[model samples]
Target: MCNNISFLGPKGTFTHEAAYILEGNLIPYCTIPAVMESVSNGECQFGVVPIENSIEGPVGLTLDSLAHKFDLKIFKEMVIPINQNLIVNPKTVMNDITDVYSHSQAIAQCQEFIRDNEIQPHYAVSTASAAKSILGDKTKAAIGNSKAAEIYGLEILKPNIQDLDNNETRFVVLSKNDHEPTGRDKTSIIFSIYEDKPGMLYKILGVFEKESINLTKIESRPSKKGLGKYLFFVDFYGHRKDKTVQNILNELDGLTYFLKVLGSYPEF
Candidate 1:
């Protein structure tokens, strides 16, 4: 069995918690691309990185990296509920904090709280990184999860500080091989249309509709080629190997300028 699983971390990050649900030795990397590169080069058997958040939308770097740099397939997926907390040194109180640090997504999640308290918000590489940086500083606090506070020996000055309580993040496990058809699976794909014509996107989407395929999610990101040019990312319910799904792909092949099957994995 493969042993090492790389995740975005220095420990105490939300991705670290998501890594716990998988088997093998957990290794931490500083960035999402680093984690993917570890898996691509076989340094690790698998890697976990956040793909999207309910409140903050898609993680652009992760999506862009998968679309452009990595050939790895998504082997599995996990969705975890999020709860952000205000973590600080035990000796520090709310009045002592002038600046707060955390991942950009985490900071955005707690915008209301930060504005209300008039604390300067700074972005860190990861939530745990932020918590670790303020270990002895009374003027700085971090917005992270409870586990981060515990791991760093910090205190939670405030709990559940996110703007919304239903916050969740979706993480994907990257691996060299696609998972076997699990009957109930979701396939992710990326494609760019041929022209800027008005019906280009509509025609491509119609391929799925013609087959009655149920699409779970759809979003667009810049292709980085030029302005108004984009790549479309889609998730749908069905394994890539399914006959119906295969036929849909065959049809899409002719309609798109570029097409790539990211992977098929058991849906969360």
Candidate 2:
């Protein structure tokens, strides 16, 4: 078991909440990159980072880091249901809120609420940070989870304020080593096409199709090495140990300029 784990936090961020479910000594860093760096530098045995939100799509930095920076393995995944609430200092009332605050994603999730309430949206680095700032202000409110309100001793003015009732975010657990396959597992990989030519991507995808592998997710990110170049990240429902999966990866190696299996773990 990992003795120490780190996550993106100042306290009360969603990532911090995810870490609570895993057993470890919790350390909080201020940014996503910092969290990954802590795990890469051995400051923590594992790191928890948000990968994507149901409404917002893939987290760009986490995807980019997996492809370009740290050679870490995604050992586990946690799916959390997101519930954004309107919180405020005890003295603040709905009528008193002129400026609303929360993380950028939170703001996006609560667009209808913000627009309906007629408050200016102020973006904070984290929902907890926004909740913390409501300490002495009466004309401001924040959108965050119940944990943030409890930690900051604020009042929840409204509950379930997110536009959609079923909003969720997927987070991944990062570690230095890979795990053995469970009967049910998922593999993640990144590959760059040799050249941006017609059917180049289609031909690469054909290998997966021919093998009958089920792809769970696929996303492309800038390579950062050059313009118009991209690295494709994919999640498929099979372990690297499986013969069919192994054969497909072996063939994929010859089809791209570079191919890397990020990691595989039991499906969540």
Candidate 3:
């Protein structure tokens, strides 16, 4: 029932692109932190945020926000192919570029290219924003994508410059209500175990194994409330309606002090 959406942006950001792919519309916002806040406060009916990237790993801020501040549910998922491009102002060419600007993740994905080209990497707020900044400085280039280069009217010096060609980012659609299954689906959950206990994770994962369910991803984040406690977030490849997935949840329900079924949504 939720219609209005929001995402990390000043527009032209990958999060914005991911939102477009998920909702087929633009949800205006300025940052992932802002997008999560809007969903938590009901400022928007739904929000989209990048959870992980194939080349760069987890987005720590998004995971932490989901773990602590929000009671949000992920209603859908989207996998957007990342194609990092080296962009420069129309007046500037490849050899004239001395420094590059982009979000930290973008810089990380294009590390090899930057190192090999001897271009200094400067972290900007977002990829789209980096492209904007490049428009102001002729010597400064940016590492973003083709969409961003197009949006900023910058010339693409290089395309698909990411170290990995299979680079993809996973975005989650968040809302207050759970999603109905679309036959093929995926479920996301978050839980934690005692920091001092060994094999606790193995036993918890064994539940999924015993039920013959496949885990799509597993990641750990600092609890933030304290130094030692940690939280684990997992994505599994089935809907909650499936008997095997339900049984796996039933087993987990009795074993963990804290557990939350974040969502059951059509897997993309």
Candidate 4:
């Protein structure tokens, strides 16, 4: 197993939380691209990247990076609960808050809070960077997490300010080797059909249905080879080693023109 892990951001971001869950040490990068590149180039033993958020849907860049550049496999999965806290300089008060700084996704996740408080949102590179920026300006406040507030020595003006109480983000740990099944596992794969004919997707899904396998998610992205072509990426709730999952894949192998099993990993 790999000890060193890298994630997106400097520190105090949700990605950092994922890295903490994995191994307690995180090498933070400025962007998801950087994180994936580091892992692809073997700069780190493993890399964690956000795949989806309960509020904002799938992270497009992460998905695209997985589809395009990385031959890396999913080693583990983690779900980090998001709790957006309003943080500001020690001297700043709630009334004096003018511009609110945060990463774009963080701002979107706290849309209701921002709207209710009439706080103008400004984008920063990351949540930790936002906190740093707020500390530099007395009038600026940040919508980040408690970790960020603590890291930057900013006071929490308000806590748990996210719109959804159960807000969480799912992250995937990437490496060159597949993880051994831990009973509770998930398999991810990408496939392209011969054609976009009617009932083609249903026909593909029927294989899993017949095997009684459960599907977790299904997303489609452009094949990027050219216009019109598309690829279907899917996550299912079973390890590849399981009999049911194996049967489903055997069925799918007969149907798909191109298919790749990304990995089978321990579920978060």
Question: Which candidate has the top score in TM-score?
Answer: 1
Positional deviation of 141 in candidate 1, in angstroms?
A: 0.9
Residues forming the 10-long window of minimal summed lDDT in candidate 3 = 19-28
Q: Count the backbone clashes (under 3 Å) in each candidate.
A: 0, 0, 0, 0
List, residue by residue over 115-148, the lDDT tens digit for candidate 4. Answer: 8888899999898999998776767899888889
C-alpha positional error of residue 6 in candidate 1 after TM-score superposition, expressed in Å = 0.4
TM-score of candidate 1 versus the correct structure, residues matched by position: 0.97
Give the distance in Å from residue 79's predicted Cα in candidate 1 to where it truly belongs. 0.6
Candidate 4 displacement at residue 91 in angstroms: 2.9
lDDT of 1 by residue, 1-268 (tens): 6699999988999999999999899999998999999999999999999999998999999999999999999999999999999999997888999999998989999999999999999999889999999989999999999889999899999899999988999999999987999899999999999765679889888989999999999999999999889999999999999999999999999999999999999989
Tens-digit lDDT string for candidate 3 (52-90):
988778889888888777888988888889988889888
Candidate 2's residue-wise lDDT over 1-268, tens digit each?
Answer: 4588999898898888989999879999998888889989898999999998899888998988877788899999889999999999986778998999899999999999999989999999899999998788999899999989999899998999999877999999998876699999999999998664667789888999999988999988888879878889889999998999999899988888889887889898
Q: CA lDDT of each candidate? A: 0.94, 0.90, 0.85, 0.86
Off by over 4 Å in 4: 225-229
TM-score attained by model 2: 0.96
Candidate 3 to native Cα RMSD, angstroms: 2.0
